[model samples]
Target: MLMSGSVSLYTDKASLYDVDYLSKDYAVEATFLQQLICNAIQYSPAEKPHLLDVACGTGNHLQFLQEMFVCTGIDLNSSMLAIAKQKIPQAIFQQADMTNFDLAEKFDVIICLFSSLYYLLDTALITRTLQMFVRHLTSNGMIIIEPWLTPDKYEEGKCAVQANQTANVSLTRLSVSRRQRDVALIDMYYTVYDGKNVTSFQDTHAFLLLPHTVLQGIFDSLGYATEVIMKAPFQERGLIVAKAK
Candidate 1:
């Protein structure tokens, strides 16, 4: 029951950040992801690779990647997938769990960004997902994963705040009380203000926090040529790039 008691403090809709919120911090995060993709493509031997974005939230990265590559997006959340579909009508989007998910086709590039891989809190599940990724990737294909900070690197009970204003509404969110159980859970509280009214919401979300070394080892065990890049643009975070052997 890790992260069993978590809650999301917003409306039934996905975070406004998914649609309208674009702060400097968010921009920076997007830039970092783009750079990672570019680097992977540059290093990959495959030309015109087919790309898959797992846990593809609102399809932000998919939309960005489609310009240069044939991209497909998958997510478990129907609402998020709906949004993604609207954003990238030309791209293929599907509903699939990150773990225990299978597609008949193989991909040349697979990416799990923004700590989406963290949803599989158990190490065994994470390893299983990695194996699935390997099976679905073509020879010489590469897998890129970005996971949240490990528990040892996180500040217990830490808090962070973000705010964004749009033409129609403004949003303020507070993330507090980081919890480390079998899974990492964060308590998020959000306040949404429309022109005439204000509303509040809360939801708890959980993510797995695996050690960097463990991820590298799993990639190796799966016959991947692995590399680890730590703290690229954010402290306490890292990326793992694994190419099929």
Candidate 2:
């Protein structure tokens, strides 16, 4: 059986999460976001902006978000946060749920990347999470959400393989995901070989396959200045950019 919806694949794989995701071209992503911010606000923040990355995972994006904004990361997994802390000790990290969290400070930019929002799994949870993002943003802040695949875009029983090797450690991941009704049911198998030892584990993840119109409706109902950019990373799943009304 799949575990609770709150389960994170990174709970045990935090060490390698950085090695995998951090290697992506984050500078390009950063540049894109910067342009979005400029186009949205028509000016750069006068001072270093405070950025909050919801469901930040292993803080791969933080390395670039921190370049233009002071960065803070929040994730559901403590192990992930621990690894993120070590990787970017200068930034702040917290273990917090995206659907509900309280931060004393508001952020100039809030982001949830890599289809993490779909983990909310239902309209109620997703709405509450959108409220959380709005509540945490400054007066002029923008929220950038990278959505997951819609039902039509999702491939059933899709499989992918990834492997990385270093002098002391070798790691491999095999993932397969299929739609279970309105959710994407994913099974990920990971194996790590550290020369002297070997370990393996599996994690199951669930993502809500929300329709595009429904997501846009949420933004419209919230009365935000909303725009969906078609040219985004990751198979052009699209990006949702919103600002408070």
Candidate 3:
């Protein structure tokens, strides 16, 4: 299980995650991501790319990426990986930290999406992880990331409530964000009513508000050409694609 950072939310409660993002269009996001990878890989080409998904929470993106590429996913949360494995049985899923993992293989495309990098919360670890991403690339590989909010984009005291239900189960999560210096501290309360039973839990996630320049600087220093694409499925955020030079 993830011992710290934003992964904490999924550590024990992977089942709740799908319900949390029930409104998100992962298929559409995956389509956009495929286009992003398509444009970024002109410098290097692969007929059938081997894609590594870092912090793949529930294989939502990989579900679609697997249709187009050979997919492998890694996440710190075992519970999350369980759901991911069940979804993409054809793909490989492993439990590993973003900063420290050795698959002993390289991929043509590496992706860490849905603001996953913000969970690193440490500059050194972030750089180290990006270095690992570079190391795991096939020299022609491209990296795509969806970032968390920057300082200017982050607003404190924002609250979001999401609820989803099926015939047997109902899940609801109340989330609120607060600022702690460069960190966004989010507190989540989840309630699950499974017809015959009721359970409730609280999870807190802390995400780093790393600036775009700082992120791009690490990519640039690693001999990557970084660009921030203004278009994305999420209106509140954008995608960052960095290609090997």
Candidate 4:
């Protein structure tokens, strides 16, 4: 659930989320996801596989995935979920936390993409989240996660910037990354200019940077047959594909 008593970090600019990721190849990624599901699990065309997307921000992936599977998307941010609902009106969108959610239905494939798993911030939380996923999975279901930057790949004091524009709005986002022990911290500043007004906001995001060995160990401990694709298509963060052993 969205944390109460305080405004969520994403509340102000949820509408701009899609504009920020305009260059992402969601269609290609969705194709890759479809292939991964087909190859990883056994299913028939007559019965389309059901898929649940955890932390499905703005439904960008689901927009393309709905064509391939029966899709349901969940996100903790209401603002993000609203945008997703607007974009993919035909599909189901719900407000739910990744660590704990009960939809009362099972799925053939459950995917946590865009490095969302890192938000759990610790191995115990990550493990509990995966356990929840397993409970909601079918006998032959698969769990796919796109992990965050590993320890070896993380670069401290790195600064990145992006600028985007629409007919009525122009925006710039600046990000500076740092490391704190096993966690990676990214502080982001956004400056947006509308035709008549300008505004600025700042947000900090933290992720528990898990190494391949640690992540693989978690899967192994849970009795899953897992594969880690080092050269994943989109983020280069590598992808984890796992099935019940």
- Candidate 1 residue runs with Cα over 4 Å from true position: 1-11, 19-21, 24-47, 234-236
Return the clash pairs for model 2, or none. Answer: none
Worst 10 residues of 1 by lDDT: 1-10
lDDT of 4 by residue, 61-179 (tens): 99999988889999999999998998899888889998899999999999999999898899999989988888999988999999998899999999999998888888787999998
TM-score for each predicted model, relative to the true structure: 0.85, 0.90, 0.92, 0.93
lDDT of 2: 0.81
Best by TM-score: 4
Model 3 clashing residue pairs (backbone): none
Model 4 poorest 10 in a row by lDDT: 1-10
**Candidate 2 residues 1-245, lDDT tens each?**
22232234577557777554535676787778877876775335577888899988877788777777789999999998887788789999999999889988898889898889998889888988888888888888899998988888889888998888877778777899978789998887777687877767777888999877888788778777777887744446788888878
lDDT-better candidate, 2 vs 4: 4
**Alpha carbon lDDT at 136, candidate 2:** 87
Alpha carbon lDDT of residue 222, candidate 4? Answer: 82
Candidates sorted by TM-score, best first: 4, 3, 2, 1
Better of 2 and 4 by TM-score: 4
Segments of candidate 3 deviating more than 4 angstroms: 1-8, 42-46
Candidate 4 collision pairs: none
How many backbone clashes does every candidate have? 12, 0, 0, 0
User: Could you tell me the lDDT of residue 4 within candidate 2?
Assistant: 31
- Residue by residue across 22-101, what tens digits does model 1's lDDT show? 65354465567666667765543455568899988888777767766788998888778888899889898999888878
